[model samples]
Target: RNNQRHSNNDARRPPKTFMPTNGASRTSRKELLDLIGNNPGGHLDESSRFKFETKLRAYANTPNVDPSDVLFAIGSSVYGTNISFPVQEQTNGSKPSDEEEKETNIIIDFDYMKAFMKDVFLSYGVKPVHAETCSEVLIEADRRGIDSHGFGRLKPIYCDRMDQGILWPDKPIDVIKQTDTTALVDGNLGLGLYIGPHCMQMAIDKAKKHGVGFVVVQNSTHYGIAGYYATMATDAGCIGLSGTNARPSIAPTFGVEPMLGTNPLCFGIPSDDDFPFVIDCATSVNQRGKIERYAREGKDTPRGAVIDSDGIERTDTEGILKDMVMGKCALTPLGGAGDAMAGYKGENISLIRIELFIAISLGRGLNCVRTKCISVHHFKSDDEMRSKKKKSSWDIVK
Candidate 1:
């Protein structure tokens, strides 16, 4: 029965389109705009429309793909259905040959995906609330078009870590210190998926009492996305700031050894516009997870983004991954390979992120260490900083 359903859908799928060899040019903008039509639900205004077009041009320039095809995929994403985009099909970690065009993906409904994930976590001894929290965070990533951190990491990162005893499934998150506007927490080596939301909520609650709140957490595993916590603050009518320090994978300027993490910093600000102002990004030129994704699709990592042990640029996806694990390769700083590009600025930002949590926690006499910080600043109705009378919320992070 399932096989029959798959065959039916495959027959209805649109034929793949041909990709342009060169990047999209200015002359192609009008054609691309015609293909996408007006923004659905007015989700994007003129400024955003211009930005989206710029992004499409960049994607078109990516090796072996057409800009129009990528734009079609974007359209499909917006409408919540397949819209005949010429996206390259991916199965497992391998790309199939041209003869495999008939192959179709098994589409699972969103609710089903969430339920399955919740069940999987429950079976691993996770508390019901914690399991649901983790499931929702992962699903939100997919809903917002961030497949890299979504269900893709459910098994490999979260479940496997739980099985190996690296992440405590139902562990209690403990508070080591607290004040009217500040807090220090310990995650008990639990999943950050659960800990992150809990702490962010605590910060929001504190902001309600005072004008601003700051919370620092320690000993947590990978959180789904930094933007999630920031979004939480914006939803509560407050400005949000969040960042985390991870295992070192990025090298500082003028240094060959990996010394700093790809520490991500995120901000969410309330606005009168259709969408709130949100910015999220890592301090490095590119995240290691992206390299893994490219490797999965049998594509090479972009040039100048990675360096081997001898400080030479490397592009082989598989080799880079191996070398990164062995501490023989490191991601470049945000500006690129050297000081001339101001890569040192990214290095400084990462160090500041680490210091924020460390210095603040130590001042409070908290011994917990492993940096993750969430801070919120609430506003009153008559606050001078309010942008306008309108209220809307949105999130953006890379």
Candidate 2:
């Protein structure tokens, strides 16, 4: 039964996503508008779905198009499993076999995407300015083709979280400590999608004054795209750095049961061109979410992405997910296997990450609750340590 359900979905394929850019020529814009205007019957019923309805409505209102035309344009953008374009013909003295369309084209106005996101959040009762900032972070990810972190998250963030009371639109992100080069931000348990950027910008401001800045945050929810914050730092003429530790998905090498989060690391380097050089990656060989994505598509995963319940590598995406998340399996570290095969190096890096999470955990006041926390019980004040050194010198002379 499960296999049949999976096969049925695989026959349908995923929907085609649309994203527009800023520099499209007028002719291209007109052609796109006309294409959409000419085809309006294929959209998923907007009135029945929460997130998609909001998005379709927004896409419909983009500048210089009729409401009727918007519906047609959206309809034309629909894609399914059977949608394919021929590349060449067969050659029995005839042409070679045709090639399939290799990619999908999506045109989204960056500005319009932002405005629509902002409107959706506000209509849903999020505060005005917070809505705008959240929109900026989410849409920027779409512009970059990072769909997992883009509009795809709107439901969990705004809709589902609203249902769960996890999203606090009115709660403020408070800065508890500040110096020339550092600050501590408390999220008040607010959405990280909103607070992450706030804390990062504070870091950027401090960096401007001291040539480097750092901020530690606690009680924050998921920050949409790590690159958004990192790029903000780079835009200020400094290299931007961002990382966040989440619910654990990684297990220590040789040890079982998950204890480490995917703990993504992101860096944005300034470039001479229009776009910054951005690299955002999860520390594990693969993100747990990516495995879920493969499972949804009825595809097999590549080797080395995961281990099964019995500690054997497997290609079945769903099996990998069930094993990893349920504590029956754990992901491989950034490097494969043990110290002899760079396992020790991966372990060392995880240790460094532990220190980082420790620092964040400490600032958040959650470290004390850790069952097996790293001990930091012995410490000497600077003056006491200096006096001890002097006394030791006298003993040596004696």
Candidate 3:
């Protein structure tokens, strides 16, 4: 999912116009709302509608995306391979109508989907602006092919968190410290969709005045795809970089414990080409999100992508997912197994460590980053790592 404007598939060619129309019958816009969480507060206000239209235009015009190169179409899965859409299939005791085969095969309109998601959040009492931001960031993931982080997360990650009273939708973000080129922020357990953009914009503002900007945020939940935030900088004609940590899932080379997250690092650079250079990937051979995707697709995880507690490579998607959470299996770092592939250089510098450093400095633990973490400790060879079994974990500061 690099920031390359690759050609979209011919079968899923985007409609010439994106102004949401109520033409599709399989999943008409009106019927589409029926599946959006039964949200009692079920309508986008005029302000939200206007904002969504503007947001749509903004997304279509992002520097890292080319309208002509995007398949902003519909599909069954939110991150469908064919750029289709997602709608839950309805199944009661009624006979299956040709259309109601349980929203299975439903091709939802993009705008309709976003509006529906927005209303769902609004009903949950999220601020209108935050709701809009949440919808925009998520749809961006689906559009960019970062399916794992796309709109599919709206329910499981967000709705559930908010329902559980953990994800505060309207909490005030706190800026604990600031400097000419850097800042530390606390998300107050609020939506990352809003917090991420807000902090990144702060950085952009700083960069405009000082030629460089950096921001560290903690206490935020999934903020959608990091690439989208980087592109915000690219859109402003500046280089953008971003990273975030996930649930600990990777093992250090020579270690089987999942002490590290499948942290992803994202980079966006403005280019003369139609699309900017947006490179985003997790440090692990496969990230937890991709593994979740594999499970949803009913596919096996790739061999070497993960290892069991015994350190044997595994490919069972279900088993890997279960083991991952239980800390029984660990994702392989960017490099493959063992020092033969230099897996010890995990993601170039343990971004997790950098995140820890920042958050620790702030008196809390913030999670996010991408880099191979290595200590300055000189070692003769891989043999040294094996021989010094009691060696301390490599410090990422170096």
**C-alpha lDDT score of every prediction, in listed order:** 0.67, 0.55, 0.61
Candidate 1 clashing pairs, residues 3+ apart or interchain? none
Write model 2 residue lDDT over 1-398, tens digit each, in one string: 00111234444665343334333333444554553345332122344233334444454445433222333332322311111223334455555432322222223455765775576566556788898888888877777766667655565455556556765666787777767876656676666667776677777777777777767665566776677777877787778877765565665676545666566667788889988887877767777656655754568987765665466767877777666646887776677544445654554455455434433334222111111110010000001111212223223323
* lDDT (Cα, tens digit) per residue for candidate 3, span 189-240: 7787787888888888888888888776656667777787888888888888
Instruction: Please state every model's RMSD to the true fold in angstroms.
Output: 17.3, 13.0, 12.3
lDDT per residue, candidate 1, 127-213, as tens digits? 899889999998887767666677656766886677578877888888888889987777878888888899889999989889889
Candidate 2's displacement at residue 84, Å, is 18
Give the Cα-based TM-score of candidate 1 against the true structure: 0.67
Model 3 score (lDDT) = 0.61
Candidate 3 segments exceeding 4 Å error: 1-106, 351-398
Worst 10 residues of 2 by lDDT: 374-383
